[model samples]
Target: MSPDRSQTAYAASAADLAVRALDALRGIGGTAMVAEHVERAEDPKAALAAIRVVGADTFAPYLLADAVFHPQDAAAVTQSFALFPPPVSTPDPPPAGAAEPWLVAWRDWAMAALLARLAEAEPDGVRAPRPTGAPVLTDPDHSQVSDAPAGQGSDSHAAHGDGLPTPDSGAPDDSGPRDTDWQRWSVRMGQLSPLALPGLDGPVHSAARAAPLALARGATRAVLRRDFPTAARITRWLALLGAEGVALPLDPVPLLAHLRLHGGGPRLALDVAIARRLLGLETV
Candidate 1:
């Protein structure tokens, strides 16, 4: 097949996958039920199934964090990780708000929670050395650094210190791609303006901090890396945050569709579509 034909075929396959993933998500009832299954299920397989249904949507990190921290089965936990595509060597950047203070905070919290779980699951897992010159996680709205020394602001330090997982300290495995990719993305995102919503009364940053533009860059990076799970997760958050009054720099539905057509797999594409529907951004 010609390169163009192959590309077209791949897009068609991805679109079909996105549709199926959306259907599966809709059939799962709602986020409340998905969270319940992850938190209360006695069987890891059942939880994993529910998670698969949830895919990389907004609630994924929450559900995954719960499973990671409170493992029903170690093998199941490992399997759940596999449900996500392998970490692409060149992941597309995260969707808009990837570096927004609120989103970053949430992402860091979820990552930290997962790392903590990994630490508990494998007491003797091989530890990787912490990378030097790593980007420090910061609150975009505030100038305060999260990793500040203990005495500077005890309260702030207590609240946000090390919320992000350090790759060298407590990684689930020796593979550094996840951390490396995430760090690189974070640094890129940090260069953007604060992700404040339109018409919302808050600390105004420069107009350059457009949400849609930021998200577009993020989605592209995520797609490049074939990190569909992260792509889906970021898309959902973008929609949710936009609904909560954040201004989007661009229409997300078309952007998501573009990603679906270009590189994202079915599950990832479907996840974005589902988020768009839920946010009333578009109808499936």
Candidate 2:
């Protein structure tokens, strides 16, 4: 089949697989059975194939995360990279009003996490360098030198010098802080930036020690704006961080459920639940 047709087919199969996984969770067999089924459902290659079929769609990263966390298996983690291959170069920013931009961001963060896990598991394997050096912001319109009054843009640039540029950079500066904020948050989480994956030729443990308050602030703003998809996506990242022992400024579970209920669809809902469970949060 063609690429598009294959993606459509994988989406359908993944949806069915998610439904079965959810049912297994809800069934009398409980978590152990769910784990068994998740393992038995596909081997490494097949699972990777299914994940690739979905591409960067909303549920793909979540499925990969589930495979990484629940199975606690190296093969699952290794296969995830097939879907989230190494960045060839700095990626262009997401298009204006792109459908599910959050998913794209999530894929990058998820890959970074997977690489970190792999490095930890196998010290001799590939390892990524920790994010060091000043962040390099490259905006075509905004010169590397800030136009803002001295000390004003200092913190903005210092805090997220590596942030992805907003599509609406041409808009009035005050027009949409939320959009701008989300872009920076995505970059800080190593979304589009050049934070190389671990197990490649860099330092291990390179994730930023981002302030919890900043993450909470952006998530709250996304929630207030009724941008649940963005909120949910960010919350998912926070949960991933939390799984790695990072403390969060706030509990993202409630907001995650809210998004899952509002309109996240079955696949997204399953993804949210899986993320919560991985984080030791209640998933009811």
Best lDDT goes to which candidate?
Answer: 2
Report model 1's TM-score to 2 decimal places.
Answer: 0.35
lDDT of 1 by residue, 1-284 (tens): 67776555545533443343354444533333333344554443445544433322323323222222223333333454455322332222222212224333322223223433443543223121211122233333323232311101112211233333343333332333433323333323322111221222221122123234444455555556665555554555465455666677545666566556654455555555555654664344
RMSD of 1: 15.2
Using Cα atoms with residue i matched to residue i, what is each candidate's TM-score against the true structure? 0.35, 0.49
The list of candidate 2 runs beyond 4 A from truth reads 17-47, 53-163, 166-170, 173-184, 187-208, 240-249
Candidate 2, residues 80-197, lDDT tens digits: the string is 4544454443333323222123334334444444444533553222222222222223233443412110001112331433334443542333434433533353324422211222
Candidate RMSDs in Å, in order, are: 15.2, 9.5
lDDT of each: 0.37, 0.42
Worst 10 residues of 1 by lDDT: 148-157
